[model samples]
Structure formats: C-alpha cells, structure tokens
Target: MRNHYLVIFILGLLLSGCVTVQLPGGKVTSAKDVEYKQPAGAFKEIASADADKSWISANTGNTISYFSECGGKSEPTLKDLENDAFAALNESKTLSSEEVNYNERAARQSRASGKLDGVPVELALIVFQKNGCNYTLTYGGLAKSFSAEAAAFEEFKNNFKAP
Candidate 1:
C-alpha cells in the first residue's frame, strides 16, 4: 500500500506537469507560481478536454451549465474578453440587468453575472498569451443560489491559469 501510494503521488505530479500562464498583461508564470485559491467542493463534475481543450465544469451544490475552453486568438486584453462575455450573456433573458466589466488588476480578466430564463448565471473570462488561448467559465443556477455560484466562480477565476 505504501509503495502504491507513493507511485500515485508521483503520477499526480507528473500529470499536472508544469502549468505555465501568460496573463493579459504579458506576465508569464506557472500555475503554481500564482497565488490564488481554486474553489473547492462546489465544482465537482469535470469532463474530458475536447479537441479545442474545452470541458464542462459543474458545481457540487447545483446543476448548471459551466465550461472552459483554452486556445485560439492572442488578444489578452480585459476589454476584449469583457465584450465577448457580454455578448455571450446577451443570450440570457436578463442581459439588461447585468453589469459587465473588466478587471484591470491581477491578469486583467473579465467577469459578468445576471439571470437567464429566471435562473442566475455568472461568467469569468481570461486570456493567456503564453498559451495562445482565451477561456471562459460560465455558471448558472437558481436565483437564490446566485451568491454561491458567484463565489464558486470567483474561486475558479482566482485560481485560473493557462499553457
């Protein structure tokens, strides 16, 4: 059992490898190099990465649509991502109520939240120049669960990385 545990641990590290990220600000660093807490527990379901390296993410507490796609385009400006985020959220029934904005600090990412078909939803988007990709984390749940979903999504943004 001890030997097996050791092997598993080593493999885990190997699998994670060295995660490098290039923020929109042109700062290149590894995932471990960044200081952010990835939300735990809330996000439980994870699917395999597809051709574009996109996958679905789920919260342990609720069933909603959440996904992340890494790749394509090199524009890492927060403004660019913010526009994209807003457009995506436009599909929601409550776009008029959302306050979409860009975060200039800490990687200069874009975040937005609002309701869709009576359900609340939030999004976190970022661009990684090093990885040559832009990714988004979209989560939706009950109106009452908006706070929780936002918190969990924030955790994910706080710990987000690329390359």
Candidate 2:
C-alpha cells in the first residue's frame, strides 16, 4: 500500500510538470529576440537578477535596465506601469510624458525627478507591450547631470527593436 501511494504521488508530480501554464496574451517561454543598440559611450553590463539586461555608464553614474514580464491573467496597462514606475521613487513627479511609436507599437516615454536614498535623481521610463510580454526600459542618474545623460538614453530608446 505504501508503494502504491508513492507511485501515485510520483505520477501526479510528473503530470503537473507536463501541464502547460498559459499567460494572458499567450504562452511565452522566455523573453527572446528583443534588441536595442547600446548608447554610445563607456557603458558596461551590470548584474541584475530581475532585469533581462542592465548597463551602467563608466563616465557617468547613469544606469539603464531593461526587462519584460510574461503577461498574467490581466496585464496592466501602460499608464498603470508608468504610475508604478514613478511611485517606486521617493517624492517623484512627472516632468514630461508623451506617447511615442516604438517598434511600430504604442509606447509611453516619461521623464521625472525624484530622490533615491535621499539623493536627488532624474529618471526616464519607456513602457510597451509585445508578443505576450510587457517591456520596460528605465534610465536614471544624478539630477544635476541628468541632461547630459539624456542623449544616451534617447539613443538607446530609439534603437529598441521588438522581436
């Protein structure tokens, strides 16, 4: 009887592993084929478990991170993601925001300034969705030199390609 119960439990586990989990838009095994040209400058890849790719400027402290989330049962809208982005910062306010086309899809670009660890920081965020995955690009640096970093971020943002 004990062996029979063990066999049943093993079968259940095997079946569960075989079961496919589908996302809202579709099934996405991983975020692949998304491409973007790195900004021209001394940028280095940084380690980030949460981000698919991340970079930091050797010249400036500016950093950029890109990530995608597999759609859930109810994927959040761009506005929702944008609001969440600002809310993640301390005392952040939108400086400007506009809709832009990104890889032929509607995308939102936002600029803001906020405090990080009590230090003033400037932020830029672009959010869009494609192929059952939501993509986000975040750029941030010290508020004082943010303008200088903006061009690099723009270059990176403009060259983004969705797979």
Best by lDDT: 2
Report the C-alpha lDDT of model 1 over 1-163, residue by residue, as the tens digit: 3433233222222221223344565653222223334445545443322111222223323322222334422454644444544553434432322233322323434445554433344444443333443434443333444455555656655565433
Give the residue spans of candidate 2 off by over 4 A: 1-30
Candidate 1 has which clashing residue pairs, if any? 42-60
Query: Candidate 1 overall Cα lDDT vs. reference?
Result: 0.37
Query: Candidate 1: minimum summed lDDT over ten consecutive residues — where?
Result: 48-57
lDDT value for model 2: 0.67
TM agreement with the true structure for every prediction = 0.43, 0.79
- Root mean square deviation (Cα) for candidate 2: 14.3
Q: Which candidate's TM-score is highest? A: 2
- All candidates: CA RMSD in angstroms? 11.9, 14.3
Q: Report the C-alpha lDDT of model 2 over 38-155, residue by residue, as the tens digit.
A: 7678677766655677776666657777766664555678887677667656788789999988867888889888766566777788888887777778877767766776788788
